[model samples]
Target: MRATTTPALFTRPRNVAASVAAAALALTLVPGSASAQQADTEPVDVRLKVADAAPVEVATTPQAWPGELLEAYGVSVDGNDLVDVVRDGDEVSGERKRLRQGDVVRLTDVVKERKTKRERVRRGTVEVFTTELKPGVRKVVREGRPGTRVVVARKTFHNGEPVKYRVIKRKLVKDPRPRRVLVGREAYAVAGANGLNWGALANCESGGNPDAVNPAGYYGLYQFDLGTWRSVGGSGLPTSASAGEQTYRAKLLYKQRGRSPWPTCGRLL
Candidate 1:
């Protein structure tokens, strides 16, 4: 009588499912739970400083720069491509910056151009007075004689390569105008060869014309052949000069060649 048999009742699978459904329904019925979940799922926006630097000051106007910068950065904004990264000294500040989404970087370099000097000579006829004996040695005559004269003149030439780009294919095509630079003076300075004698030698070689290019492709006031020019350390010399500069280099070369570097003008040196 004290140990009565207890009946074990089996719960139907449908009844278990109903309990779980009731629990889910109770959770949905909780106040502000759905709103709390939404708040937890929302994304947050954050501000990040670049290079750990303070904010930079930016200019209201745009500036101009070389196209090479565009090639290095390969950058674009909105729908327009950048030709250069020009910052106005007065308008831009170290604190200046812009909003960007993709990979961005800054690069800088100094560009140099090859300079060539050329001279053109002209032939003309002129009247000359001379004493000449016509077989009998009895007559002085004035005659028009043909003569070839070399008037060394200078013209500067420059050529530039297009900026290399991999991302975009847009560029500004321009007709390059040769800029005339008086390099004869400065070229002689860097020539660092013979002071005034170098100038004299150059005058003899290239007529003190910075743009004087010989038929053999020799260039500069110092009638330097491509090989010889490079041999005598012409690699570092400026491509132009004035009379004073030409003389300066000429003297330096004279010292290097030691009174006989230039057989033709060594004495002058």
Candidate 2:
């Protein structure tokens, strides 16, 4: 016998049958499968069939601020709304009033009027009266009587006759005349230094009566009230004695106090 070498071969029976079935199926289905794959892989012109949706509606409203704002400055308002007051009441255009919390709503104009001063009137009065006098006649009197051989009395008159004559003279003449006068002569005099106009002051004070005295005991051309006179260095001089002096003193005071002396002096200063 010749020496023979043989190669050993091993095969799984289940795998072999599967492989044969796979080969048969591949041979039979490969063309159809390839065409199906090609159809799936190829890009197609796709179109989405989406229906038109109704337009979504959004609710919208205007926003408003809570309260009105006032823009006016330094003006008082009298109405509920500041703008109305400034526009209508004040008649100011482009200047509407701005209102704020705790604000007082009243408007007014501050006006100062010139002061009116009444002239001081120096008061004075005059009095006159008549009285009957007896027991005296024209430098002669009857002594004894006509029955006792009668001493001749000069200028002939009967004895024991009632005479309608009386001594007519003033016993006491007080400030016997009412004169229009100023109340503050000294004050006026002092005012003279301050360019006080005496022309008008005298017209109002005493009408230029140096002897004028008021019912209130004010005396002199300036008609110084008793209290005022005493205060202004008045020496209680009779109105006649101290008119000039009082005026001088008053002018000095005017210079000191810067007050309108003419008012006190009835414009005399």
Candidate 2: stretches off by over 4 Å: 1-194, 238-240, 256-269
Q: How far is 230's C-alpha from truth in model 1 (Å)?
A: 2.3
User: Each candidate's root-mean-square deviation in Å?
Assistant: 27.8, 49.1
Candidate 2 weakest ten by summed lDDT = 64-73
Candidate 2 lands at a TM-score of: 0.25
- Alpha carbon lDDT at 13, candidate 2: 21
lDDT at position 199, candidate 2: 45
lDDT for model 1: 0.34
lDDT of 2 by residue, 1-269 (tens): 01111111102222323333333333223333222334434321111100111211111111100111101011122232122222233433232333322222222212222222223233333222112222221222222211111121222111122323333222222222243222323222232374666445555777877788788776766666667666666666548455556666555555555445445654334
> How high is each candidate's TM-score?
0.23, 0.25
Query: Deviation in angstroms for 79 in model 1?
Result: 99
Question: Model 1: runs farther than 4 Å from truth?
Answer: 1-199, 236-252, 259-261
Residue 184 error for model 2, in Å? Answer: 26
